[model samples]
Target: MKNKLFLSLALFFCATNIMLSQNIEIKDDKVLVDGKEILKYEKINFFQHSFYSLTDDEEILMYKYNDNESREYKEDDYFILNFLTAKKKIECGDIQKVVTGLGMSSKKNMEKLITWLLKEKVIDVNGILNTNKLDTFYEKYNENITERTIR
Candidate 1:
């Protein structure tokens, strides 16, 4: 009887460990794996000219925006919910791609991500891709220009 109880307990513990290891509960700015947060550090991508960002434990999280949404890892608007949980900023290209997707995104969502891109200097006040030159004829005549000296 003692041996059988011990064996059952061991099996239960092993099962629990396996289950826990397979689940990751990602919150807004924290990553929880098996109820324990992974070790993380700040990273400043100089090549891309980005500010300090948080990352996962030695892993670059590439979230899928293919629209196969699930409650476990749902899309929290423009930025990947998972990456936000890791406290990392999304690239402009990534944001644009997800933004243009068929998923129904809120106005505030578009404004937030677009505002972030503009703030980060990722995209200028123009079209999507920077490869094309914008025709400034409209801007040269259409836009109202005024000079007001600051006190």
Candidate 2:
């Protein structure tokens, strides 16, 4: 009986460790699954008990996983743009709207995306409009924002 109880407890602990080891990866400003980069913004469903509203009066919990190694900001910029363009293609929404909805509403986030796009040649700087001009472009091209080829 003692041996059986110990085995059961060991199994339970092993199972718990395996479950907890499945952590969400945030690397190179991109999320990964099994080391493959995930390029689109994926919606996650939370349990009701785990869901907490974030309003002005409420403090929201944010997690940042730093790898403790310095990476070139330019390389990060390219990856970010590639990720955003891929996400934009997969999801029919303005980049800003999609990112903001995904809890990346800060100016820094926006800048990173924009800079990445420019660096990657996804959006030509010469023809690129200012941030203020993006609204009009968004409105005009909103209909074309559906899932399409990311050219």
Candidate 3:
């Protein structure tokens, strides 16, 4: 009976560790994995590491517009605007300007718009803004202009 109980407890601990490893939370500029806040030194390094891992060239290609399909840039514009507003916590006004600068006019064409920007060399892989920055909003609430998307 004691051996069975010990085995059950070990299994429970292993399952708990697996669950804790998958999700990350941000609050007050601190990163939490499971319930514990990661140390400051680890936080920045971890963020940088994750950021580098997420952004890649192929992901950028997926958002490009295909003119042969008659896709409009507006669709992409609105998509980007909404994404930026939600992810960066930026004002709608600011997002509009950024979207316009990218030649995107509609939310529906966001995919194509982003692709065009990348193809035109207007926005490089590192230059394109990332919407996932919203994940860190609870911590810093600061807008990051340099964030890029990851596939």
TM-score of each: 0.22, 0.22, 0.18
lDDT of 2 by residue, 1-151 (tens): 9999999999999999887542234344433334544332222322000111112212111212221233443221111111221222111223442133445534334334434433344433332323433443334434442223253
- Candidate 3, run of 10 with poorest lDDT: 45-54
- Compared with the true structure, the alpha-carbon lDDT of candidate 2 equals 0.33
Looking at candidate 1, what is the lDDT of residue 134?
Answer: 18
lDDT of each: 0.34, 0.33, 0.33
After superposition, which runs of candidate 3 have C-alpha atoms over 4 Å from their true positions? 23-151
- After TM-score superposition, what is the CA distance of residue 100 in candidate 1 from its true location, in Å? 17
- Tens digits of lDDT, candidate 1, 1-151: 9999999999999999877443333333333334544322222221111111233244333332222233355342222322332333222223453253445433323334334433343334331212121122112222211122122
Superposition TM-score, candidate 3 onto the true structure:
0.18
lDDT of 3 by residue, 8-45 (tens): 99999999987744333334433343445431111223
Better of 1 and 2 by lDDT: 1
